[model samples]
Target: MTSRYTLFLCALILAAFNLRPGITSISPVLQGITRDLGMSSTSASLLTSIPLLCIGFCSLFAGRLAHRYQSEKIITLFIGCIGIATFLRFFTNSPWYLLLTSLLIGAGIGIVSPLISGFIKRYFPTSVAPMIGVYSTSMVVGASISIGMTTPLQHWFHDSWKIGLGFWCVLALIAIPLWYTVIRHPYTAKQETVQTQPASLPLQNKQAWLLTSFVGIVILLFYCFTAWLPAIVEEKGYAASYAGMIGTISMIAQLPATLLLPVLLRVIPGRRFWITFFTLSEIAGLAVLCFTDITPIVASVCLGIGGGGLVSLTLLLPIDKTNSAMEASTWSAMTQAIGYMIGAIGPIVIGLLYDYTGSFVPTLYLLIAVGFVVIVLGWKLTQPESSQLEEQTVYQT
Candidate 1:
């Protein structure tokens, strides 16, 4: 790789690192945040769900924003938004302030995530799978570290939850310089001659909606369980620390697969077997956690591997199916916007069910049913080999 590609590659990996740690870090210590902020179960659920809603809403405009302002600057600015908001967590003792800052953080993440996808498509189209693998790997590493370390950090900070949360701002500090370097050189090929700009979103296309739903299902499963998994584990008679580590397992397990999935796809090309197998792993994992108490470790690892693989697949779908970086960005932004909007329901519904029934059993069952839907969708969404098509109908914007 040339120096430019190497620098941009570093920037992409580092930026991926920032997008998730701040979000997943909080889940491990969510109960503490609630208690400290005086949040009821319902309000606490809203705390997690609200950011997802912001991510979804702000993501809808990421493509246009990047087009107007340019991708590199827009990404840097959004990462700036994330950093500032993460730092502000140091001062936020009130639930309202937390919510407000989370809104800003989510907005940054929402915008930056798709742009990162676009960046990869532009700079590394020939090696999309491996680059995306690196991207996904960085995210999971960040996420797993935060979840695993938060409780210890909280203890080290004398049980102050704010410091545990605020410490993640350093992620942004690391990312900003790397990304600044990425856009400083003209990385993306100038596509001025191509008619890539769309008249409107291609929501009317069946494939577009299919891609949207595919990611929607993934995010719904991801955010919902991530938001509440620690608390649920604790309620299941595990200690808080144990629950937190177990939660970390679900995220850490994603790393190997994130690094492996791309290579596997290169060898195997079809997405159905991978998606179906991992989705079943998630089901089995969740079922083990819910129905039997025999091996929580095994269950957590299964869930992690499954959820981690989906992250790779969902991110890949837009790029795989689309023809150009601009098209990939547009489809990715749309997928995130629509999918996250739908996925945001998981936490609220799980919270309401938990509060209403006084058990997480119902919550687990609901997630399992959702997995069945994911299977059906994954079955259809699996790309038929290009060679299999007599004539292709490409999704156009």
Candidate 2:
């Protein structure tokens, strides 16, 4: 690769690294936030879900935004938004204040998500799978680092969670300058002209919705683990710090699957076999949590591998089916909108179910059922040798 291409590649990975720390960092420090703000578990859960909801809402407009302006510029602007939101967390004295920050962070992340997919398609068309592997792995790495370190940071700051929560702002701040460098040089002037008005979103296509639902279900499974794994372990009599480590371990376990899924996709492009295997792993993890007396760590490993592989697959689906960067963005935006909206339900539902039943057992059962549904939904998701873009002729815009 040329030097410019190398820079853009590094920029992509760094930008992705910023994506999850804002959300996952909260999990390790959730108890401290609830205690400090005098909020209930249900209320605290919103810190994670509200961003997801905003991601879903903001995702609808990502294509329009990217088409209207320089995508790199828009991305840099939003990365700044995320940094500002994370910085504001240091001053959060009320639940509402913290929630407002979550809204900003989510909006920023939502817009960035689809645009990055387009960028991967635009700049690295031949290498989308491997680049996506890098992308998804960066996200998981971000989650692992944030979940693993936030509690320790809290302890280092004399048990102040605000410092821990606000620390991630540095990541966004760091990403801004590097991404801005990409904006200084355009890929091609013709590329900009072509994107002036790309095709409308694929809302009416059966395949699109199926892809959306699969994205939603896998995301729901992921955020559930991201939001609750720490607390679930803590409830089993472990110290808060140890529970946070469990969550970290789960995220760490995902790295292998994230890095491997792209290679596997090249060898086995069809989704059926991978889906069945990953979802079975998920079912086993949830079953352990629901019925067995095994350590939650074991369950975390299984869930991590399962959730990791499935989510990586979902990220690739829209790209695989669409033909161009703009088309990928449109499909990605639609899928992310519905997908994240559905994902938003995971944390809140688990929190409410736990609050209602005074136990996480029922929630684990619900997640297992959701896992089975994913397997069923994924049964038809075989990647074809040709683009399915022409098949999505139902609705536009």
Clashes of each: 0, 0
What ranges in model 1 sit over 4 Å off? 188-199, 383-397
Per-residue CA lDDT of model 2 for 1-397, tens digit only, reads 4877888888888888888988999998898788878998899899999999999999899899888887899889998999999999888889999999999999999999999999988888667878888899999988788888888888899988888989999998788888888999756622533744656899888889888988998899889978998888877788877888888888998899999886675566556778899999989988887787788889889989998898887887898788888889899999999999999999999999988989887888899899888987887654443335324322211
Give the CA lDDT, 0 to 100, for residue 124 in model 1: 78
Decoy 2 TM-score against native:
0.94
lDDT at 204, model 2? 85
- Backbone clashes in model 1, listed as residue pairs: none
Task: Give the per-residue lDDT of model 1 (tens digit) for 66-139.
Answer: 77777899999899899999899989869999888888888999999988888887777677878888999999
Lowest-sum lDDT 10-residue window in model 1: 388-397
